[model samples]
Target: MPTISRQGTDFIYQQVTRFISGQISSGVLQPGDRLPSLRRLSDRLSISVPTVRQAYVELERQGRVESRPQSGFYVRARARNALMKPAPCRDCKPAPVRCRSLIDRVYEGIHRPGVLPFGIANPSMAKPAAKGLNRAMKRVMARAEERSIGYAPSDGEPSLRRQIAYRYLELGGAVEPEEVIITNGGQEALSLALMAVAREGDVIAVETPTYHGALELIESLGMLALEIETCPEEGLMLSSLRSAIDRHDIKVCLFASALNNPLGSATPDEHRQELVALLEAHDIPLIEDDVYGDLRFDGTRPSPARFYSEKGLVLTVGSFSKTVAPGYRVGWLLPGRYEERVRTLKRALSCSCGLLQQMTLTEYLASGEYDRHIRALRPVLEQNAERMTGLIGRHFPGETKVSRPKGGSVLWLELPRKVDGGHLFGQALDENISICPGMLYSPSRRYRNFIRLSFGHPWSDRIEAGLETLGQLVSGH
Candidate 1:
């Protein structure tokens, strides 16, 4: 969605190219992974078949992926050289959060007008998604009965719950409609899941440089966060997780199942299976934040850890915010064995989410437009991430190390240790640009020399200028 001139002839082709490149960098398209057939991909992304072909040809030219006469395009094995995985943090003990003020300051600058938005993780509202949701909302509003404006069932609108469960079927998840509890957003779902399994003063295992919101919630709830080292591309390091498990009484482990923030790592299928087994062995519950699971650039969605939890120990949380509509504020939780407890918590939290929003999303899903919109959206996101990473590499210091995420819209950068991330944040803000300081991502102030940049917005000359300014600032201007 980066600001491309609508008049540009190669807009669609460029989108496809960036999407494929992002998939390659982010590990969504593993080495030698075959890409979708042109016809299938064109149908899937709702672009012209020729556009997909042209994009693939372009990728071949760049050596990002390759093609054969009979076989389809496969990600070139050499493309792996572009991705650099950061060394995992070593401290595995629980650390009390102390970055509240820094987080609040970063968020304050995030929505300020005229500032380059390289801070928030969610994508900019694309036209197709906006139009689809709007159409659905108008239809629902016109047909609404008096009940449509009243409080929804605490478990959420039945139709919406059913649609959520059905979508999970694609991921091989066995969520029943009755098990889905709707909440305000993924945040509420996570809060409910944590409350269902753990109490105050308990320790929760989390990925290093994990979602700041999770750390904030844990701090607010009087819980301690045991930080586990996570790989830049593959997500949580299971060995570190196990070590933390042995060292601390981790009541619950909260992690991203796909497209983790900042690092943009997606755990492979094998890792997901092993992660589930490890936690289940210790009788610990796992809360999986899968809000970004649907935005994979590889065009093939990865299954969440909850799909592997046969013993009902995995609580899966997701939302429409990241993909469809953030303003809708609609999200759900598959509470596993703690359904009743989560339902009670939802009722206690806000009674119910906005009824009309839930109804609108249900309508949107039923119309089968969600698939078309997601297909289009993922390519745009991948394109944006690809461009942003390239910009950072070209403009930032040569010693900088950046993560090549398989999906998601954020890039994590490890700058020279001499660089001060806090100062970089202040300088960027002074120039009307916003970025997330890496220290805020950890409870123990790790990654102080790093920063997380969001490529969720459409690219533009102004964005390029901002990056140039950031480069200058980072180089001690």
Candidate 2:
């Protein structure tokens, strides 16, 4: 997990605070939405009851949520003053003593006059698809009388799930309609997957330079991580994975088979097939993150982990947030073996998706509108990634080595050891660049010299100017 600081408060309390804040920001905990009981939260996140209570006390103090005595805690209606961001402590938390993610560093580097950032993965939204999507949402709203008011299904609408399953085929993964479970987003899908398969203190094998978000999830669940080094060209290094497996007992290995976070490398078909075989031979399960499966800019889509093993050993996670209307927060997972367990977890959490969202997406996907939108999106993403890479080459220091991913919107950069990006974060914030640092991705807290750059957002003149500014900073360094 990205090394986060404790605010002199206990760890559980701190985690509870951040959890509520994100839920509030995302509207998941709608205005007046009742929060789960302290006992419930304690059991859920596996913290002490008192720890959950302390966190709630802080939330109430800030008016972010309310306590109604006998009834329970309810989400307080706080006016979002964009200025009101949650502070971790009296001071903004800096990088930990050891860096965790290079994605974090790219964000820091962008704020300076130097430091060209080839970090953070974000898709550009200024394209025919985005414009078309805006129109599509408006069109859907035009029939609000016929839409909007219906309550949504708890396990997601049948139609939407089917459509989502169909989209999987376009990407080369065979997903049956019954196998799909719609979620609030990829995060929810992942959380459900974790809850379904793992218990407290279970060991989950993760890629060496993994996504920090996944690492955070593992830590939150009181789990230990076994890191496996992956190659730049071949993606995950299975030889090391096999060695780790033989040496230690593990619960599951979570990986991105297509374009992974930060690194943006695609695991080849042979390696992917090998991964499935290795896991099956070892009787280990895998959580395959294919969120960026549809964003490939060139060549055939890489095969999902599902191809080799159809059962519970491989659960393929997907999300429309990156591809379609991000704000819709629609995502799904094809849990081959753990299907029932994952569904049960989803029901416990939020009880399925909004009816209107499901309907809109179902219509979009079934009508073949989704494929056309993706077809339009891919080229722009390719162009943007190429453009950013060119900029980094011309601007960043010569010691940096950047990943040339075939698809996806993120570029992972390997910087010189002379740079400890965690140290440079405060300075970057001063310049207002707002990029995600690189150290947030690793579990062992190394990788202080890497960064993740987002090439997925709209490539406008302003963004281009920001890139130039980022380039100049790296050149100056």
Candidate 3:
């Protein structure tokens, strides 16, 4: 075995992890193969045994290898199998959105209690962040002001906006408090952005197999959807987008700023800049959903599309629902050039976001614990994701392809040719397991064999059993 050396920027543990993972990926280390003893590896690599032990611990957390009681670490049988990335979609013209009938049923399953939740793209409630948020809510309620009970400004509370803007600056984006508009949730912010930019019968551009909510929003607004082929790793393809724009008059483009739903792809910084330029060249506005940006597995957060657009064409809608407090329903939008339009829409649609919730969130953010909370939350999410991915790899069919997302708590799956995601959805629910069928994520019924599974809930025997049931169902057992 080749020894580890401090030849690169990676830490000793990270280098060891890459070396072992690479070995597994190359099939040099077969399933159930015992890893070299810590002492042996330490001597071979001229490193400490503690470093080797740490690498093994990290690998176990990644679900690539597991420690057997009184035995050495062994490569997991499932981890030996490679997962394929989601295939790129082809260029297509704008068409009226045709939502699947199963979409409503899928959501009903997600909301229904007693069902194993692998459907909704929510944050893990098992984290301590929930308790922190609850305390914040109680604090606001204890000091209840008449203003707290009253309607807030349609644009949002100045304090909350300033806090959000400050957070934006941390991500290397220059946003002013006045540029932010608080909305009920990310969905509402997106709705306002859609309504602000396009009229009935207009065309909107979006990624293929995107968040189902976006497709529904487009349909509800009486707009046609122009599906752009998206990559599982890179997000929206600029070439596909440019092609679609050339063929059709795309009124506005709605995309995920990072960790897009379903596929969980984060558009890189350079790609984001290109996207901004593309939208600016066409003079079309971009509405970006960045709810998942903060949930990145990596500690560093990605920049919003607003960071690159000099023309101020990127309207970013984000919510604490995915990160901080779901019930709080606190979300905000930096509408860029359309700030006034979104503010006006906020007044016309609903007076404002809930005042008490906004106050609670303001206190939470001001406490300066929000960053600490997220830093702790990200690892839990990452471990959960790894656990789920391993489960899927082990249980699902050999032909199954799953996304290995760098961030986000959801996993996108493409099952064997014989499997039907809609039927699987129904079958899984019959077993009290809820999974999002792939058809709902797209305007057309393209990914009928695909599905999205959430690791937002804590991992347990119940979740394991639910996944086993899905694997059996997929295998037609």
TM-score of each model, in listed order: 0.84, 0.73, 0.85
Error of 1 at 450 (Å): 0.6
In the range 1-477, model 3's lDDT, one tens digit per residue, is 665667777889888898999998886775546789999988988889999999999999998887855657877646444444435556466777767467789888988889898988787463747777788878888887576888788889888999999998887778899998999999899999999989989988888778998998888888988778778777777878887787788899998847788787888878988999988988999998998888886666888888888898889999998887777788988898987788889999988888888988898989977877887787677667766776777788788888866677788888887788888898999888899988887776688898999888766898878888889899992
Cα lDDT, all candidates: 0.82, 0.69, 0.82
Report, for all candidates in order, the number of backbone clashes.
7, 35, 0
Q: CA shift at 374, candidate 3, in angstroms?
A: 0.6
Q: Where does candidate 3 stray beyond 4 Å? A: 1-88, 126-128
Residue range 117-226, candidate 1, lDDT tens digits: 88887763532378778899889988997767898888899999999989888667667899889989999999999999998889988887788999999988888898
Judged by whole-model lDDT over C-alpha atoms, candidate 1 comes out at: 0.82
Who wins the TM-score comparison? Answer: 3
Better of 1 and 2 by TM-score: 1
lDDT, residue 463, model 2: 60
Model 1 CA deviation exceeding 4 Å by range:
1-83, 124-128
lDDT of 2 by residue, 389-445 (tens): 655655566666777665777767765666655654444445555455556766655
